[model samples]
Target chain A: MFLAFDVDSLKYDAAGLIPAVVQDVRTNAVVMVAYMNKEAVKRTLESGETWFWSRSRQQFWHKGETSGNVQKIKEIFYDCDRDTLLVRVEQKGAACHEGYFSCFHYRILPDGGVQVVGERKFDPAKVYGKNGI
Target chain B: MFLAFDVDSLKYDAAGLIPAVVQDVRTNAVVMVAYMNKEAVKRTLESGETWFWSRSRQQFWHKGETSGNVQKIKEIFYDCDRDTLLVRVEQKGAACHEGYFSCFHYRILPDGGVQVVGERKFDPAKVYGKNGI
Candidate 1:
């Protein structure tokens, strides 16, 4: 569906910020959602990797730029919120950079026990699937 | 359905980290995603707010403590990743904190024009719904 925004285009709240969603390109699984300013989004589109605006640090970040588990962009879409975006990508190794395929690998049960979701796609220790750059 | 992880619990690759998904509790809409190490998860649960471990900073952060638009914990879940987490929460005013509801507020049309999605739920400039606590 076509979205309607407050102003035309994504009008960041004087902070030059926006939201981004990470979706598994193949399975259509929503991996995670993070915020990004204009630069972060621009960097992601240019680098084909995931980058986000660190609200705390007040800067830009490229996911796995140091870890090497890069996310190659397949496609990107925006939700009804022109300020939010969905990024579909082909994750090379661990998107979490924690050695997990996705960021959502755990669950907090009603009883208080936290259950870990998903599996280990790679090893953050040795680092799996290095593209041999 | 209950998820089954490869290992017993969240087995982060020597990194002690996990994945987290942000979902809007009311509409069940996914906001955006970001990765967090163990400390981030721990802080969020304890604070009853969103705290993510910045892999770069390698420290725990409490959302809204600085921004003021805190996300009250409505519910949090984990995907099958065993290492990932899905956090469902009641966003106070604007979840994005960037002045929009969820972070998904844009769409890249087939023609290449980026269509802004969603609306400005609140004015980021004035900081609405401060609760005045």
Candidate 2:
């Protein structure tokens, strides 16, 4: 329902952040979900790629900046509540830092067991180095 | 690699909550993403279903308690960062309150146009009443 480009209508939490769900445009597969501050959103819109505010690092980073798995933004939409964003992108390489196509590589079982549902597209140790790029 | 059942290792934000990404077990399609408190996590693990702490309502509610669109938990996994959760479940009926199978029903275009890529599964007015149940 949020078909307009009115960013002001979005309701940011007290942290001044909103969640962005990134999905592969072609496959319709969810690649990853990340948090975005106002600045990050603005940058993403302007650049036509994904930009996210890292909670742990306390900084903003462009997707695929460190690695080559850049997400070329195809379209962006807000939920009816305007609390979250759905970003469809052409994901290159892998979305997971661990080298998986998606960050959601594992599936959990009823017995609390995990199975690797996604394939390892690349190796983190090779891409990010032993200490992580 | 995060196969252990050490819930303590999870890093909740300053708000004492972690993001839970819910996906369909069979289709592997992401249904929705929500937040969970420590109590919600414990209850979800114990009950073999989903329990979420609503940020808006500031309360806890069981999935499908009102609409019978309950999510049967099959497995749950935390991201390597320990800040996010991926919950694989057998979702019943619709996941979106608006009657879509998933919250991500719209696909965005590069030119900022919107397309309804997902089919409507139910009518919210009938399920939740005139003003929401």
Candidate 3:
């Protein structure tokens, strides 16, 4: 049961943004979650790459445009509600800005303890600079 | 590499909502993505169950409350950005209201086609009635 990508069918928030969850295609590991606006969606569709609307930067950014950890889009799906997106991609390098393979690096224990699960792939400071990229 | 769950360090959206991506603890399959307000987070933590703030209803809902498809939370982690949450849960039944094991049932192809990858677990109409639960 599959459907075509119909932008009109999606339900964007009042801010005209929708959530996009990225996953590693090979491992099926969820890498990161980000927001996408109309422009970002259009660009992602056109470029076959991940484009995100940064809430903090208040702008559209191409994934790996700075870090070279580009996410080549393999497939994309919207949930039944159409407010959320699941994007399968071929991830290059690490997904986390903190130099991890995925943004979900920490694990919460049953007793309220924390543990690091994912391995560090690179040094963010080296790639993004000391102030951060 | 891991950090503790500090609610104070999180940066909630302007609407006081944070996105939470739920995954199956046993399978590592992403089940659903929902939003959570401060109250939802508190209740989920206290109850050991998944609680979400439905955007359409504009209210908090305890997962599996009416449908009995409860999600027992196993772990919860916030992304480095502090804007997203990763919740691992032990799902009892179908996670999607549509009776699918996951809300992400449809898959998009590279050539703009769609495919249904997951199997239906139950009949939503039978469970929720004609108009749906």
* Order by lDDT, highest first: 3, 2, 1
The CAPRI classification for model 1 reads as: incorrect
Chain A only: list TM-scores of all candidates.
Answer: 0.74, 0.92, 0.94
Lowest summed lDDT over 10 consecutive residues: which window, candidate 1 chain B?
Answer: B1-10
Q: Which stretches of model 3 miss by more than 4 angstroms?
A: A1-4, B1-6
Ranking by TM-score: 3, 2, 1
Pick by lDDT: 1 or 2, better one:
2
Top TM-score prediction, candidate number: 3
lDDT of 2 at B81: 62
lDDT (Cα) of model 2: 0.79
TM-score of each: 0.50, 0.83, 0.90
* Cα RMSD of predicted structure 2: 3.6
lDDT by residue (B7-104, candidate 1, tens digit) is 23554534676656677677655665556665566667666678877554566656666556677777676654354566777766666655667666
Q: Best candidate per lDDT, number? A: 3
DockQ for each numbered candidate: 0.19, 0.33, 0.46
True contacts kept of each: 0.35, 0.24, 0.51
lDDT at residue A26 of model 1 (Cα atoms)? 71
Residue pairs whose backbone atoms clash in candidate 3: A1-B116, A2-B114, A2-B115
